[model samples]
Target: MAGSSLMKSRFESFICDANESVAIQLVCSDNELDNEPHNHAIKEFNPEFSHQLFGDNESIFGYSDLRVKLYYSSAKLNCFLSIGFTDKVTKDETNGIEADDVVDTIRQKLSLKLCSSMDEFRSLLSKESQFIPYGKLMDSFSIDWKTDEKQTKRHFEIYSADILVPGFDAYHQRMQTFLWWLIDAASYIDADDERWQYFVVYEKRSPNGLSNGHLHSDAHNTYCFVGYATVYRYYAYPQRIRPRISQFLVLPPFQKCGLGTRLLHTIYDFYVTDTAVFDITVEDPSDNFTRVRDFVDSKNCQKLNAFSVDKLKLGWNEDMATEAQTRLKINKRQARRVYEILRFRCTDRSNADEYKAFRLGVKQRLNAPNQKQILDYQKLEKLKKFPEQELAFIRQTTIPALEVRLDLLDKQYKELEEEYQHIVERLAES
Candidate 1:
């Protein structure tokens, strides 16, 4: 449900491409361009016409057909906009359209000056800008990453729907558009959904702070948008709520800086304290997300008394199930999975006796569904007794299949362990 306040602004119709595949990227800042005496605009919107356009690292990749790049300033004064189209799409054979026509269409939509030169672009920005600042944030925190034995701190903030209300806020809508470029399959959600929550990470810096450093302003609480996640609350049985993480993204600039982990842990902290929360879940998590979640969950589950090395060896008991569900709000199935992982970590695979016990334990669970089939085969066929049927099953189906399954499971465990190790290493560093 969109609120009454959602209205079109100056940059509303900037995207001119009819193809949904065309990506629009924005690099914006809130800092006033007071020092800059001139504005900047795109001289050439053609990508392949020039060698290595937008510099080496800034080039857009993976799109064979088309791409639209936008660069603009969101300062209090002197707003500037630039538009560019990739060369592959400019070819009539490839795109079935004229590149110049597409660029013209975008220019018409943005209603800004076109620049053939840097000086001209800068001159256009010298004029007064109509940039409206994004709204203030509610809660914030800082996470630090170490570089060359030095710690660098990043500031992040959390926002609720009420704080960002009345649903149609300009920043909220702008962010939805911005997210579409970076997040695959990104779409706008109902801001009116009371169960939805948002978290944003920003690269904040004060006016006097170093370029891209933390801003020292108490008066202006708006931080430069870095990355964000959207979560929805689901009604669980027995008067509890399950918060399902929906879309998660950390911009390329802020990625690999350990902010994703911080953001996820922050969400967990938010829900874990709620009296009505049952457990947390994620919706159709990607491979990257699965790794992050597994790492976070394994760490959290390890602290529970029921998940200790000894308790884990005792197998998945009610204590493990009950404590994980009651205290950590983890579901029974997930709790059991976590228990197995922790137990595997404690096992010394080099020892035959210990390793055999571990394999037997896992195999018993793996073969559980086939137990009745083996019994039925023996009883109905009457060719052999229970022992003979079991032996035949083991030779024909069970052992061979178990070998393949175990190999796959071991590989998965090893991969998960590697991912978990990375998180733990970062946690220790941070």
Candidate 2:
């Protein structure tokens, strides 16, 4: 009974749709309250538009005259009341009503068909209870892609110029931090899962860390070649990719910049070249079809199929079977299981873990040789320094402050050393 008030409030909020002309009111009264005779009112609004726009019936170019009947429907209002509570108010004492009696009276009058059960009518209201339409869900989770460069730089900068493939220690630290952030955000949304997973996009970077050269200077410049080791393993063969991309959005300031596009292109190049992958499959939130389509088109890619789970069993073909087998070879049975889990069942921690394990396995495979080469190169490069570049960077950028602090510390150390020597000499004389 305590929750009845909250339910009533929620029901009242549901009636506030502008398209539907409906309103509900509730009143309360004491047992001794004198009540007036109840009367319900119904009103219907007339349609403003006429059927003449479609032309008269049996009229060819309005030449033939024919009679037509067009009845346009409009919004209608209705009121009803419930059966009176005889225990609370006697038939002779109808002049005075209790709060329960009033509610019962309203509910009875509201019932137009006495033969129909109230239980059946109550079932109709259940349809309106706490449901989100598919269209609304799609609209809320749409992804927006940008083609501009200046915009992308505002959000994510090139933190590292060279490969800087995160070491295992660093990767573990970053992965832990990333998991914490994911848990924190998911908790806010009351999501069921506490685990988070992502696929790492490994590719070559340009010397300057710019994917595309100066936007204005090079219209037909030779764009950098960013090859993918195994596109299918990195980008495709994952279930969460679609929902993740849909809900994962870049800020407005990051749009129109080449960052998103470049990142995608890098992945695309990897799939196309290194992996020889012709088709890259992406699952996008239903709302992000436009963004996904645009990205596909920009990369000269084509949509192979709009995948759904039921089709896997009922409509499995030779081509799909072969592809599934290939995926199994690369990723084992886990890949197929992930597809099945994501397609038929609700996304949960198990699916996330499966996806994460598959990804880590793929990355480990690719990085085996690449990781060794990177570590060896970094070790050798650390010994060499470009004095000119270092001086330029310190003078042109904010590094001068750091240099100034070093100079002050050097001066203070020298003065302290001199004072210590004088104190030592004084002690010797004494």
Candidate 3:
């Protein structure tokens, strides 16, 4: 028992949490790279995943103060990976459990050139000036930036699908390597596929530090990635294409600063303008992304005549969905959601009749699926003649069912109203 306890305690010293052990930094300038990367990691953050790179335990044994520093040149995303530890448990000290192959495992996940040393990565970073963004400049805007001391307007640009340009896929891959560090379920998309498209946001970074205004000149603009979204244009059978957002992330250094919202708004504009596109969709969006999407869609719909205060109070209408689809490319399901949000914004909460009408309108839409199911049942051949016995049975079943559904509807409506209220509150703030 004494020996067993000693062995367990000894192995515990070897165990290191992979999530904490790994560190990522976006190196924004040459000065940052010239110095030791370990100390000056600009906005250091840990990856959401360690298992995908480290293994089942999501830990690296045999090391203490184990920090796997992964640095990248902010503009070019030139990768520099270094595995450091204060101590390493050796074969002589352990009872067979081995240290995880930390370096090799991470290298396999990234296809880009992995510079093993700071000097080598900095050598590649020197050529950043030649790295022009591949796609047509889609949009550029300046935002007010603030820190502990002062405030200045920072500039950013969004580019449409870089993979479409010949020979530029390498740069796109370098950019995507950041996703693995941020997105929990991140995976590479087939850049070769025509169906996959990308929208990337790059900050016109000043090598000195984030400085004011459009780069002293467009000719002198040095870009670093802020965030990006992957869109897959799926074929809608006979004609038209539906673009679904597969991945989205505004790096930890830049989130909560409206960069995600800006990127999403720009992508929406990209699809809404494309005549071949049907409607925008998302593949398993996180709750955070859904809120951003809701805000953007609702904001856009509010500008349309069909979703105006007058129309929203009149309740949900086909014209609301129709205009949203035709003018903005919002699908009916999403349009209905946008309608509810906009209606909540316009709802007269103080008036009893107005509030009741609003609830009834929302409840009607919520009950739509159940109503359709009943209509579908009535279409059965045996029930078509409306037999008295069957009618009686349906009535009997429906009374309780309706009661259950009503209770459910109220609960659902309350939840929806709460969500819409949050979105509306955000809309006001934004």
Candidate 4:
């Protein structure tokens, strides 16, 4: 007990030192290390150095000078620390150490045995009990689904924004670090703001009922972290609430497992079921997110009576638009997009007559503005100095202009058709 306390004090002191750290490394007890002692040849410390020593999402892909190695037990909370020169600057003279001597000069520090495993490490770092469920009860709020790769079940849960602010805990703080790794120009959240909501996906595991040689039946179930998203609820004019997804991330390990689509669908389900929500929205969605949303929205709309293939053939109408907004919480513009994509999915591309009909249907929507321009030109043609020649010139320029616009629209339709085809294939699997 005395030794554990001493280790905790040492670890805290090391963290408080505010030394010029370059990078940090973590290893389990099973990891091998050289027996050579750490040399302390270079001692200059910079207090303001925070050069994202961890790689993009903790991969150590970027440049970093100093390195901190964390050694922990494989399944226990035991951890030891050491400061070393990263491989990037092992020989750089700006750091005031000879290339080969840097590794020899590194120093070892405090060792801590607080929690067990990486999951427990995150639990300790979280400030709110709701965000970090370890050692806490949270059986009622979880939703589970199976992953495509491992075929293993994963769970997701929603939490109010209050749990992330003011005095954020260690686990939440650590998880927040992922934003820097995954997002561009990312910043930490204002925990005091009640407008944010979080959705987290994790792997649920049963507890072994044993802790440090003691058995406790009430030990909370373990939730191995996967990914999470942040959402902000805005009060639109009138009685509408617009929930914008501020951030969405799926860790690299879980990518391509259909988890992203599942997460998106789950979030939609949450909002669609709410009585106060006006329409769902997204904040600066990436191209990848836009595609996923296209698929999810299209699939859901297909189940509605208003978006049937027969209705889709008749094209987007007030009834289809209204049902999408009221039943699916989709905005009008996006609802129209989904309607077109679904319509293209049912199009018979191999049949020349059917294909021509599909093309004409899309072209008609694209021609509306061009048709208006032609009418305006016709009205002004009679007033020109040489009405006959001016009218001829206008016809010459306008017809080709319309053709160019149609060409561009055709390209857009083809690209959208390909995307819709992919979505349809995925839907078939589901």
- Alpha-carbon lDDT, every model: 0.55, 0.28, 0.81, 0.57
TM-score of each model, paired residue for residue = 0.63, 0.21, 0.87, 0.61
Per-residue lDDT for 225-305 in model 3, tens only?
788888998989789999899989888877877889999988888888888988988988888898899999998888999
What value does the lDDT take at residue 299 in candidate 3? 87
Give me the candidate number with maximum TM-score. 3
**Which wins on lDDT, candidate 1 or candidate 3?**
3
Question: Residue pairs in steric clash, candidate 3?
Answer: none
Q: Per-residue lDDT for 74-186 in model 4, tens only?
A: 22223334455434433232334332222222221111123445465544433211234432222222323333433323334333233544433344444554454356556
In lDDT terms, how accurate is model 4? 0.57
Per-residue error for 7 in candidate 4, Å, reads: 45
Residue-wise C-alpha lDDT for candidate 1, range 1-430, written one tens digit per residue? 2432232221122223333323332223322233453222112122211212222233332233444444432232122333344433334332343334445544543344445553554554433133323434545666675556466565566544433454324445445444434544455678667677776555444434322245554554333455667788899887988888888876554567667777787777767779898877787777777667766777888899888888877777879878887787777777766776676677787999886776667656655655666675556457554576566765576334656656866675566556645655644553
Q: Which wins on lDDT, candidate 1 or candidate 4?
A: 4
lDDT of model 4 at position 321: 83
Query: Which candidate wins on lDDT?
Result: 3
Give candidate 4 misplaced runs (Cα > 4 Å).
Answer: 1-161, 164-173, 207-220, 363-404
RMSD to truth, every model: 11.7, 31.9, 4.1, 12.8
**Which candidate would rank higher by lDDT, 2 or 4?**
4
Clashes of each: 12, 20, 0, 19
